[model samples]
Target: MASLEQPILISFKLCPFVQRSVITLLHKKIDFTIEYINLRKKPDWFLEISPLGKVPLLRVKEHVLFESAVINEYLDETHGERMLPEDPLARAEHRAWIEFSTSLFNAQHQLTQARREETYYKIEEDLTKKLAPLERKIGDQGFFEGDSFSLVDSAFAPFLMRSQIVADNIGVDPVSDYKKISKWRKNLLSLPEVQKSVVKDFEDLYMEGIYERGGYLADQ
Candidate 1:
């Protein structure tokens, strides 16, 4: 916020991490610009500034910050009502689950990218185990922790969005059975922030990526 210029978020259209940051920015109603890039053919300027050479880089004037979680934290802390809890223990718990959501995203990626049914089902089982605790944590109010949207919700929105896309395109629903998670996902997906987080053609692009991967789900 020290800079007067609008923040620019470097992104890759298919990256869930980038989508999560976009969700946070939208939820906070932050004014920003997004620059799309090809990970396969990284621009020389992008590679030069990004230490990790990753998308979702937040450029604030001359300074650049990488990593989706860090960028969301910076945006939330500086721009609007804090999405994170004020209580130390509660905040830490949310942070832990946000980190856990990263693994869920990884497993979801593996689920979509698996070459065989066995691999896909195995990944689904692992995701079930990972999502069980979150189900208990979800309140009837619909958001991750409770009635209000938080950073935790932003972290997991991408995963839920992708899952819904897979269900629509491939007949696979990783979190279909959990009643609480199902409701939570429905509510999250309904939000304008979650809805507008990705590109307009996100569903087609995501389904196309699955088919291009030649994975078991893609065939289905």
Candidate 2:
């Protein structure tokens, strides 16, 4: 393994993608510093380096990296213990699910911003349909793949956390009916890495953002 200097992570307080990378870094027990930036008021230097102008830009020794998944894979490849599977087939499957997790994030965004009852239920229905396959695939083990935590768990943790937070705010239980998902969520939440991945005021900031946007959940 190469000896890597502690990397600097440029992050936004509320981004789930950034949270994924944070969780991976923490789980792997790699040394890194996080610099929080406002997405609305991105610095010129940030825009100059990041083609996408996104958060979770990583500054490795003399180089920069963008995209949460790419950064995470790079870290796993170069830094501490690997989170991905050694088997090529298994690794491919994990990567596929990681991509699927992004769709869940999209659903969460739609659900949060929905103001009308019809729109809310529509998105909720679609979300439920999406989760059915995961519910079937997840085993009785503690984490997503098995007893050990992997990148798939890190990838999906933010989505599950967001769902529970929205449910708490709206008095609706989105994942409660899915037994496997609920168990997996409980397991993920119990991990220190997942719990400490976000800022100290994460819940307050998340709720306030929804309320400020006049979301249906906030109204309820």
- Best-fitting candidate, measured by lDDT? 1
Cα RMSD, each candidate: 2.2, 2.9
Candidate 1 structure quality by residue, lDDT tens digits, 77-131: 9987999999999999989999999999999888778997898789889998998
The whole-model lDDT of each prediction reads 0.89, 0.88
Cα lDDT over the full model 1:
0.89
TM-score of each: 0.96, 0.95
36-141 per-residue lDDT for model 2 (tens digits): 8888898898899898989888998878899999999998898777789999999999999999999889998888899998998899899888999999877778
Model 1 Cα displacement at 7 (Å)? 0.1
**Poorest lDDT segment (10 consecutive residues) of candidate 2:** 1-10
